[model samples]
Target: MEQYKKDFIDFMVSSNALKFGSFTLKSGRQSPFFMNAGSYITGSQLEQLGIYYAHAIHDNFGDDYDVLFGPAYKGIPLSVATSIAYSKLFNKEIKYSADRKEEKDHGADKGSLLGYSIKDGDRVVIIEDVTTSGKSIEETYPKIKAQETTPGGIKIVGEIVSLNRMEKSADSDKSALDSITEKYGFPARAIVSMKDVIEYLYKPDGSGLITNDIKKQMDDYYAQWGAIM
Candidate 1:
């Protein structure tokens, strides 16, 4: 695994974003482990979270995008933090935009968007915490760009998430990222994946320690769902 990826795995464990055993996901699958981005609550954690995302996006998508569009709710902070980090890291202003789940009809800065508005001739990247299914994208992608009939016309350049579970989407045999890539030409990437998680943690816990049982559970779960990769 890349050193940044390894660091991300450790960060997950340290932040309690990643946990082991019997997680009943929203998809109703019995997952051996789970990730909850909400655990990154502290100022320092959020700061570091942005740093990780900024680096990952730079590595995967480069510094060319005009905007970072994070979806509503959880994505709001993600966009803000990453925009800050991107500006600092790459020495450029990367505008951030987000949708309102409940659009407010009033205000000078009204309508479904916040931060910079999506405009013509703009390139964008969607940022998110994780994608177990492509459901969120299904809901938000159209709102980002709709004037054109073809999805390729959307200015979205790529997507970056914290983790890729590497499991099938809720409805399909293909992984969510794979399906999204097929449906839309843009790339979907992660800072680390379940494979990286296993490789980093299988030998030892985040503290360079091991509890072999958890590793076995991880292995077994992947053995069943990991064949797609």
Candidate 2:
């Protein structure tokens, strides 16, 4: 695993955002862990989070994407901080845009709020903390496609990039990204897998935060809920 990813995981653990315990997810599955990006509230914490996200983007997606699209709420800061980091580190100066739940009808532009206006056919990379069933990303997809500012001949494209990808759903037809890429031929990537975190925590150099009992519990949880991908 990359040191940056390990550090980001450690940051999540330290912030109490990433917890190892009995928890139920949005998909109604019992999980051994959870990650709450909302716990990062302070400016400094958010700045650090952005740095890690920038690193993850740089490491995984590199210059492949023209713009970063963050969904509403949690994605707002993620988009801002990440763009800042990308500008400072890679000198790429990436553009970012996010959505408002409701369209603002009376602005000077009277449309979506984009940090950088998304042009039609622009290749955009979507960022998020995690994925359960991918409903949120799917919901945001059409809105971007609907942007009036996008030129008629130009196409609006979206790809997903995230901190983690949950295990493939046992009852589902495809993994979250697979469903998108299968349809649109866009790509998806992640910084690290939950299995990587678990393995990291078990090593001698581990923070000793995850005990043998916790590992057993996690394995058992996976047996029922499926292993972390």
- Which candidate gets the maximum lDDT versus the true structure? 1
Q: Judge candidate 1 at residue 190 and give its lDDT.
A: 90
* Candidate 2 wrong stretches, greater than 4 Å: 148-162, 170-174, 204-207, 227-229
List ranges where model 1 is wrong by over 4 Å. 147-154, 204-210
User: Model 1: per-residue lDDT, tens digit, 59-93?
Assistant: 99898798899998899899999999988988989
Give candidate 1's TM-score.
0.92
Q: lDDT of each structure?
A: 0.84, 0.72
Backbone clashes in each candidate structure, one number apiece?
A: 1, 2
Writing each residue's lDDT as its tens digit, candidate 2 over 58-93 gives: 776667677788888788888888888888888887
Q: Indicate the residue-level lDDT of 120 in model 2.
A: 66
lDDT of 2 at 115: 73
State in Å the error of residue 149, model 2: 7.5
